[model samples]
Target: MKKWAILVAVMLLAINFSFSNGAGEAEAGGKEVVLVYDGDAFFSLISTSLAFHEGKVPMLLFKDDLAVQQKFIDDYGADGLIVVGRHVDAALPCREFLGDAVAVSLKIAEFFGKSSSVVVMPCSMDEYNLSLIATPIACYTDAPILLYDDNDDEIISAIDKLGAENVIGIGSVAIGNVHLKSEEEIYDYISDIRDVGYLAVTNPDDALKPEVTESQEMSFERHMKNIQITILSQKINLVGSDEATFSISVPDGISRIRAIVDVP
Candidate 1:
């Protein structure tokens, strides 16, 4: 290849990389297999790698669109996409919250199938959504999901009475009071939860290294364990004993990302 031709190719490659990673003359890697979650599901969804503070709700909302989600599939050659949802309401437009979520789930199932994989975590309607309606909220939603309840005893008892096989618990419901402190403090919280025969699913705040309970180390004032966890019932038999495996999907190129969505 001519030197000039090679130079042109390099320049074009740089431009493409900039275009995909960011706007304004950024370049994207052609062979990098950059998975873009081009779906609306990620719009407001939060990740755990962020610093928590007041007014940081955007860090934890499920607002991605379809286009982005599909792109991720194409780019990664991903085998499966589990459409896990944060929080959903029971009553609402049949097509809006739970309705749309179910639709997304179906689309994923149909598109990926046994080949690649696409599925949604249909919402659950439990007490937390109800509590939000009774109190103040950052935003309004009709997604179907259960609430964390924030109390450890309530969650464990729920699993025991309801049977762990029938359901899985999410979020800091395991950490309890210690969550208000620092990441190191969270250990005691986790210990407390485990003692009760419950599990604590990891999120951005806890997943990220040096988990800072306060928003920032210096400004160590305002912080939030204020997020919620949502769940869906499995085909679990109420008579069987089982534990739900909890995990969060991190954005491409981001490590240790953790964040929870609306609870219950």
Candidate 2:
């Protein structure tokens, strides 16, 4: 009777462990594949949207240490890997998107098949802000975000091949029948859908760094406050008085700002 009880207890523990492991895998959305990219390259970051569009797979920056990368895969329970960038070489069962940003974008689009629409944004390998804004929109819309150049034959050809009826352009990109939008306009449009949350702003000077370690949450918080100040200043401008005095109150717990005597 004692031996039977011990055996039952061990079996129960094994079943519980298996259940919890299955639960974790389900929580990870059964996405047992992760995309790896070189954090040191700006283009690598931009191309990550391909992975995002491909089943919303998770992405990790490629650490120099192979052990670290393998550990991440184990933690995420991922069995397969997709590597982006020509220089990134991951030692695993993986598919590689190897090329320049434009080439990689086109290849990924072709690999995932086409949609009725394609997002065309100005391509700047050095600047990331515009691409960052475009990534989520592309993923949400289920359209491929192609880096645009002025009258580039390759981009025009890709758009034609994709059979994209709607060519949505962001930030001064003027392709054929493309709907161009300014940065401010894009911000206003996405503000409705995007939750106001902490942002991690990367420094342009440190674009080539292997990893980003600083938190810019406080800086972003201040930027939000500045937007408030700008709105208040605009309202004050509506008074249309050359010499009007007004008191500005700073909310509690908010950082103080310099007096805006003559904000133009």
Candidate 3:
């Protein structure tokens, strides 16, 4: 089955939620950064930023990685949240990575307006850690969805056309089922602003292994630049926040490039 097995556990206890009614003023116009993660590591990252700058904690749940962070904000339209990722990926899922910033900004009014908001670094991510969000994307009620995976060109093109018609079209390739398009064609195809997705990466070594030729990387970046929509990737950083830098150790050989939504 392409779908992952998600273990859902509800916190009946007064789960240490971050929303503090008395913590700070609404500051109606101030930019509020959302730290999306489920454990101490991500919380600590949010705390570190608080050390240098003041912030308002979001009441929403989150993961330590930027990918998941973006996913939550995009779907539910929260104040903002963090994302997660593995350090070993060769090609970073740009759509999922970009979700952290875009989702929060679009949902949070202050961020959408002209303001100097730096989304704050997405909670530092790690491996396939359990994030708070293990739910499926059910964003739109009436939109038709087309499921595709690696090498399903026929289905992908169909989605593009449907989306162009302003139809609520969703792709199930966030599970890494869809194949990567050729470098040049990907740019033109995914550049449209109406696209959205849930992303996943089943092959970490292929995505993170550092062996891309300069030409290849350029093609990859070119494809990424054209992606204005959101996507998903696996290896979520679901660790919640604490009072330090949300830190996660990537297995040896992962890329050193930093991931997640940026607020710093």
Top lDDT model:
2
Best by TM-score: 2
lDDT of 3 by residue, 75-167 (tens): 443432222211111111111112232232222212122222212121223311211121112111122222222334543344343332332
Q: Model-by-model lDDT, in order? A: 0.24, 0.52, 0.28
Model 2: per-residue Cα lDDT at residue 44: 48
lDDT, candidate 1, at 155: 37
| lDDT ranking, best first | 2, 3, 1
How far is 68's C-alpha from truth in model 3 (Å)?
A: 20
lDDT measured at residue 218 in model 1 versus the true structure, 0 to 100: 20
What is the lDDT, from 0 to 100, of the residue 33 in candidate 2?
43
Cα-based lDDT at residue 11, candidate 2? 7
Better of 1 and 3 by lDDT: 3
In every candidate, how many clashes are there?
52, 0, 50
How does each model score on TM-score?
0.22, 0.56, 0.19
Give the winner by lDDT: 1 or 2: 2
